[model samples]
Target: MSENIALAGADLRAAMRICMQGKFPGVQLYAHDGLTRDGKPTAVAARAACKEEADGRKLQGPERIAALTACFNGKRPDLAQRSECRKEARAKGLDGADLRKAVDACAREARG
Candidate 1:
């Protein structure tokens, strides 16, 4: 499978863990758009839209993957900056999870 697909799988796994912890009763739907500077994992624009029945209560689902498949298949931005960041992290022997956390921090900063 492609790198984006792999990353999306990883993200979905993480999201699943979150959902389980949160005890969300609805099916999870994810929609990803755009990419971070790093080509490793693209940015995700995800939402969980619960299916509702006629009584305005949630409905069980056959599950929907939605546009997440498309997002993961789309072209990513340049990896130069992302590579540099990873290289720096590696050079310092930073923890891999820490590096990911740092990347998330940067993304949040950029978003604002």
Candidate 2:
């Protein structure tokens, strides 16, 4: 039973290696079965860029996490900034092509 379990583990690792290679293409597999080429357990590194703002205020706790998740899912947090640009243009009585040009300028300035 121990030998069968060991074989199954090896099979799983081999399958993982093949799948990783096919998907990643150029990424080198640094470890197999948790040990590195130097026979050390792979160290996992994690980072959180959870600083998100809404209406010029920083989000906290669950709100921050939710915003981070939204960012991870490809949602742009700068959408509010764009909306603000549109509002500013309208307040200045801009319309038609003039409003579009002003909004574009505001968007560019916001990005900078």
Predicted structure with the largest TM-score when compared to the true one:
2
Model 2, stretches more than 4 Å misplaced?
1-74
**lDDT, candidate 1, 1-112, per-residue tens:** 6554444677887776576757854733332223233323433321121111211442223223233322233422233345455676667777779988766665455446
In Å, residue 5's CA in model 2 sits off its true spot by 58
For candidate 1, the TM-score is 0.26
lDDT of every predicted structure (CA atoms): 0.45, 0.65
lDDT for model 2, on a 0 to 1 scale?
A: 0.65
In model 1, state the lDDT of residue 46: 18
In terms of lDDT, the best-performing candidate is 2
